[model samples]
Target: MTSARPLPQYLVSRFHGWKATTYAESSAWYRRLVDEGQRPRAMVISCCDSRVHVSSLFGADSGEFFIHRNIANLVPPHAPDGLQHGTSAAIEFAVTALKVAHLVVMGHTSCGGVAGCHAMCSGHAPQMEEQTSYVGRWMDILRPGYDRVKDLPEDQQIAALEQQAVIVSLENLMSFPFVAEAVERGTLALHGLVQDIANGSLLQLEPSGRFVEI
Candidate 1:
């Protein structure tokens, strides 16, 4: 059996501070969000990295965006195998139920998940190849991205791989029939982006298959 623990004091204090300040100031907005429903205009798929704050980056209010985070910000190819797929489920809900107009895949520089994938694929992390390593299994989704960047110079591979992560997710997003239909009907559009964490710069994937500063 698992044991439950009390909330950490730091987190508790932070929550109280927010309740007294931010939440108190926006009580009506909070109540409205509950009374009505969350109608986020976009769904952003980003990395689970703590530094990648999606809301702050876009200056989004509480209910403005539906964000999903996972290792490497990956979106696996659509699989209807009756499995518990958290990322896919979030994508389905965002696209089908919430009817989000935009789907954005945001990758970031210096991502540990992407680094692990590179290490694993390079045979430097043997333990990650084990069947019991959940992270390793999840990162297998980015193998194709790794392949695309493996030939680059060592110094350039990680950055290239990071962008490829965004590209791979954008490709995978289309594999979902609903997403494909939504794009085809001009109801939803897909975007790919890479954030330079050190400098707070953003690179957007353009139609010409290039990542350009935005």
Candidate 2:
């Protein structure tokens, strides 16, 4: 058997406050969205980090973005084997059904998921290598990124690999046939972003193979 519980009181209170203020003030917009449908222009794939507020970071309004969050903000290579794939499913729908114009894979510094992948690959965390480790299995998608940065000095290794996380996801996202077609037709654009969690600085990767502060 499993257990379920109500939301915490503090969060509930905050929700009520938001409903009374923001929701009430934008009731018409909310009703319009309900009557029509969400036609988000962009799809943001971000990490499950509690500190990364996708909407807040972009100052986005409701229904503006179709967002998906996963560990390390990873996108595994496309595999149409009739298996369950939550992230890939979201990407498929965004590219095919919703026809989003942009797909952004956002990574962040000090990410626990990225750090765990680094540790597991470096043989620093044996428990993560166990067969029962779901996180480890999921993070295997990032092993190539770790391999790319493994030779760097220890002080610069994790941060370098963090950027590689974004690179890997960007590469994987393009592996989906539909996504690739959309980009080829100029209907969709791909983006990679990395944030400095400690300083709130943002960097965006350019097509020219550089990451510049934005």
For residues 1-214, what per-residue lDDT tens digits would candidate 2 score against the true structure?
A: 6598899999999999999999999999999999999999999999999999999999999999999999999999999999899999999999999999999999998999999999999999999999899999999999999999999999999999999999999999889999999999999999999989899999999998678999
Worst 10 residues of 1 by lDDT: 1-10
- Quote model 2's TM-score: 0.97
Q: In candidate 2, which residue pairs get closer than 3 Å at backbone N, Cα or C atoms, i.e. clash? A: none
- Candidate 2 lDDT score at position 52: 94
For residues 1-214, write the lDDT of model 1, one tens digit per residue: 6698889999999999999999999999999999999999999999999999999999999999999999999999999999999999999999999999999999999999999999999999999999999999999999999999999999999889899899899999999999999999999999999999999899999999999999
- Estimate the TM-score of every prediction: 0.97, 0.97
Query: What are the C-alpha RMSDs, in order, of all predicted structures?
Result: 1.0, 1.1
Give per-residue lDDT, candidate 2, residue 16: 99
Candidate 2 segments whose C-alpha is farther than 4 A from its true place: none
Which regions in candidate 1 have their CA more than 4 angstroms from the true location?
none
